[model samples]
Target chain A: MIELFNVSVQENKRLILNQVSLRINKGEFVYLIGKTGAGKTTLLRLIYLDLYPSQGNIIVENYSSATIKRRQIPYLRRKVGVVFQDFKLLPDRNVYENVAFALRVIGASRREIKSRVLSVLTQVGLNHKRYHLPHTLSGGEKQRVAIARALVNEPFILLADEPTGNLDPEASRDILELLEDINRSGTAVCMATHNYELIKLIPHRTILLDNGEIRREFSPAEVQQLKVIE
Target chain B: MSVFFLLKEGIVGLKRARLAAVITIVSICLSLSLFGSFTLVGYNLQDVFNRFYKKIRLEVFLDSSLGLDQLEKLKKKIHQNPEVEAVEYISSQAALQEFQKTFGQDLSSVLKSNPLPASFRVVLRPKYTAPERIEDLANRIRRLPGVQEVLYQKEIVRFLHKYLGLGIAILLIFAFLILVVITILIFNTIRLTIHSRMNIIEIMQLVGATNLFIKSPYIIEGMLQGLLGSLLAVGILALFVSFIRDVFYHGIQVPPHLYPFLLILGTLLGLLGSYISVNKYLKY
Candidate 1:
């Protein structure tokens, strides 16, 4: 769960998020919709403690920005999974090693790493392509590998920043379904995307961000009429 | 947390940046070998200066009228001085023989009798062989009983006192500059290596890898490269030392401790360079 109260983020005298207050309960899948520079990425970064709020604090799980020490950021990060549009995978490593990297960095044992990596790869439907490198995989498969890596540690929440940006329509739909499947299994997901059509495909609770502020909140029924205030 | 994992990562890092690692190691090897060679030269140069200092002799000439008893007493008094390491008495007859051997001419052919005076050749302790100290001892000896004159190589001592100090100062400054240059070169090389792998490091950071977890492998790679390069340097220096001993001077000795010293220095340099680079990158 994540809670941000009166949070404002400013960098170089430019406000990215201003006085934004929101709360995400456990096991909820929330879609954060905004145009480019609408502060969607900044909000996610604040939740992960990658960027600090200029005016207020953020609480992600048990770690609070007001009290978290520098040494404790890694522990906070381990609990919050983040995926990017670029699907930042090591180019030289295969899909299996890429997924196992998450466990290896935290000093997981060989047996635990193997089991968890295989399970996650199987969950993401990429187990058959475990030995393939990132460049050889399609966009959807690459994002699946990234998701497997993010989920290897069994994080409490997953933050997806434009996860389907590079994929085609069918592939994007597949990735969205996979994310929904992950959410139903109990990990809270806060996904940021600009494509309003994806929300119509499988409607969920959506939040609209405009000009560094939350413009509106829409229920699953309201998702059909959702429109970006461009 | 596993030491083996860290070691394997370090090896993998080196393999991943094969050309960069090789360039770094070769640069370190060449620079360290040059440094080692310079140190050996400085050591041997000091030895040569020491030999030259030992050759400085203070001669105390005696009056011709002095008898055997007076000469013996004078010899005992001069030898008792703390600065004096040895005193050899050259009789007038021995002086005449020495003069004849040097010029290949008998004293009888040049004069009616031996013109050379009996003297005590005084060898000073190594610590007391400075030009000013030698001159002071000469002045004191000149005031002694039955001592007519005292003589030493004034010009040679003066040259050593002035030029030798200047030479050593220049050498020390040069050595310090070389040390700074080598450190910068190695530091930049390691920085470039880290720069090339910035994406990997960024991925590691994003995946919740602790700073220690990210930095350990790069640091180990640096240390391994340093140790390897310095070992090659030490081997090169050993060969150079042996060649100098055989072809030039047998007295040129490689101190038993220098091998380990160079190895430790090189390793420390690598550690320091890599640690700074990683820490700076991680700060972002």
Candidate 2:
């Protein structure tokens, strides 16, 4: 579970998020919708403690942003998975190595790492492409590798910022569906996207942001209607 | 567990930064070798000084009128003293022979009769090996009957000690400066290597890698370079020492502890450099 208590984020003496408060319960699938500079990235960064709130507190699992030392940030991150828009995989390593890297950092044994990495890659349907490099893969395949890396640790929550931002529509849909399947299997997924078509195709609890404020929250049908108008 | 992964990554990082790593290793090696050579020189200089000091003696030339009985009495009196280690009686005939042996001609062949004086070559105890101490013993011996004059080479010892002390001081200062400069060079080299893969480090942190996990590879790379550089220096120095022994038939003895000390020094230097860089440039 994730909760933000009147969180305000300021960067360079400018307010980025103003008195923002939100909560997502366990095993929930949520969508964060915002334009280019609507503090979407800032909100995601707050969850992972990449950027701490200026005037409020966040609780990810049991850790608090206000009291968390720099040393505890890594432990906090291990409990949550993050997916970037660009599918930030280590370029030099292969798909398997890229996926295993996450597990390796947590002191996983080679045998444990091998089995878990293989299992996660299979879940993402990229077990067959385990040896392929990132540059050699299609947009969809790269996103799958990225997802496999995120899921390898079995995190309490998956935070994806523009997971399909760089992909074609078909690849984007595949990634979204993979995310949907993952959410169904009991891991909370928070996907931040600007794709209106995605909301219509598979509506979920959607939260919209404007000018660093959480403007409104819409149910699946209302968000679907908003997507239809788009 | 993660140790295998860390080691693999460390080796991989070294390969990735091979050019910079090799250059750093060479810098460390060259500086350390110079240090090792100076240490060896200092050790041998001490060795030579100790050997020469042990042989210091006061030479008491006897008067030409003194009888063999008086000379025997003087020799017995000198040998009885606690400070006297040994007293060798060189008769005037034996002194002439020694002179002929040194100059390759009999003194009797050049002059009507040998003018060389018979002397007692008296070696002193270890505590009296100093020039001033020998000078005190020389004055004592000069007052004895049948003794004409007392002589010992005191200036040579003083000159050698004073200059050798200054030389060692200068060497130590030079070594300190080189070590500091080498440490800085290694720190910069390691910083560049880490900067090259900073994104990867950031991603590792993102994926829950601890600070130790992120730092391990860089630290290991630095130590590996250090170890390799130290080995290369030792190999080169060993060959040079062997060459000296073979070509000139004069062995330059290296202190036994120096070889191992070099390895430890090199490794510590590498660790120090990495630590400094990590402190300046790396964070969780």
Candidate 3:
């Protein structure tokens, strides 16, 4: 569960998120849709405690974002998985190591980490590529590896920013389906994307933003209507 | 999470960047070797001079015009001073005989008569051997009746004292400079090794790796570098020391006690260099 109230983010005297209030409950799948410079990444960063909110409060699993100590940031991050747009895998490491990286950071036992990493790799249908290096994997496969890394810790919620922005349609569809399956398994996921087609395909709750303001909260039907019009 | 895993990671990292690690180790050893050599030389010089100072004695030549009674009284006055440890009166004939024994073959044929002066060989306590203290004692002896010039080679003592002080000062400066140079070189080497893995660092950070978790391997690597470098340096120094003792034993006199001290110094330098290098680069 994540909540943001009257949250505003600023960088270099420019407002990125202007007094935004948003909330997502546990086990819910939500889409954060916005154009470039619409404060989508900034919002995700706030929930992830990467950047402090300029004005307002954010609660991620009961920890206050505005007041959390810098040292506690890692602990908070351990509870929430973040899938970056770019698959930030260590080039020198294999897929299994990359996924196991998250578990290692949290002090997971080697045996537990191996089993968990293998299970997540299997879940993402990349079990065969476990030992393959990041450079050897395709964009889809790399993203899958990133997804596996994010989910390896079995975090309560997953925050993805433009998870499918760089993939082809088929790869994008695979990533979306993987996220949908993850969501169905009862982990809350708040994914930011401009991929309206994928949003239509999945038909999740959609939060729309324009110029730093939440323009509308659209039902699955309204989102379908918007897609049809587009 | 386990220290074993952290150490394994550190060792693996070192193995992966073998060239950099070797460079770091070599730099540390070179710096420490220079430092250790300077320290050993300075320490031994101090030791040799201290021994020489402890053995130095003052000679008070008695006036030939004085009577036996006056000589006895003067000797009693000199022996009563707390600074005088032992004083042995030598007659003029006895002094000449001792001189003949020392340079008998070379100068015995050239001399017409015994020219050595009658003197008291005065050995003072160790604490009174300092130039100022010896000078004070010499002045006291010079004022005694029936006593001629009091000789102690004041210039030699002064020169040795000043030279030893300067050596120590220069050794300290050299040690400081070597420490700075070694730290910077090791820091740069470790930084390069870490830079190659910046992506891994970022990913680790993203995955919620604590700062300690990220830094532990580098610290361990630094410690290992220090230990290995020190061991190598001590080994090299030991060889050099043995060679000097074997081939140039008469040229330079190093006291036996300095060997263990040099090894400890080398080990400390290695540990300090590694700690400094690792701490500098391990920070965000």
lDDT of 2 by residue, B1-284 (tens): 36777788888888887888888889888978887887777777666776677777778999999887888899998887777999998988999888888989877877997899989999877655555666777788888988899887789768756776578777777777877877777788778877777778878888998888888887888888888888888877788778877886374788897889888888888877776776565555
Best by lDDT: 1
Provide the TM-score of chain B versus the true chain B for each model in turn: 0.90, 0.79, 0.77
Model 1 chain B worst lDDT run, 10 consecutive residues: B164-173
Off by over 4 Å in 2: A9-18, A33-38, A67-72, A109-112, A194-201, A208-230, B45-58, B62-93, B104-115, B118-159, B162-164, B275-282
lDDT of 1 by residue, B39-95 (tens): 777767766777888998988999999999988998998888788999999999998
**For model 2, how does the per-residue alpha-carbon lDDT over A22-80 read when each residue is reduced to its tens digit?**
99999999999988889899999999888889999999988999889889999999988
lDDT (Cα, tens digit) per residue for candidate 3, span A1-230: 78899999889999889989988999999998978878888888888787898899999986897678777878888888999789888877899988987887778998999899899999999999999999998999999999999999888899999999899999999999999999999899999999898899988889888778898898877788654222
For candidate 1, the C-alpha RMSD (Å) to the true structure equals 2.0
Candidate 3, B1-284: lDDT as tens digits:
67887888889878887988898778767877776777667766776777777778889998778788887888889999888888888988888778778867534467776666688988877666567878988999999877779988788878877887678788778877876776667667667666777776677777788878877777777778766776777778778888987887644554465546544554454445444544454323
DockQ order of candidates, top first: 3, 1, 2
The C-alpha RMSD in Å for every predicted model, in order, reads: 2.0, 4.3, 3.9
Given candidate 2, what's the lDDT at residue B134? 69
- Give the Å shift of residue B73 in candidate 3: 6.8
CA lDDT scores, all candidates in order: 0.89, 0.85, 0.81
Best TM-score goes to which candidate?
1
DockQ of 1: 0.66
TM-score of each: 0.95, 0.82, 0.85
B206 Cα displacement, candidate 3 (Å):
2.5
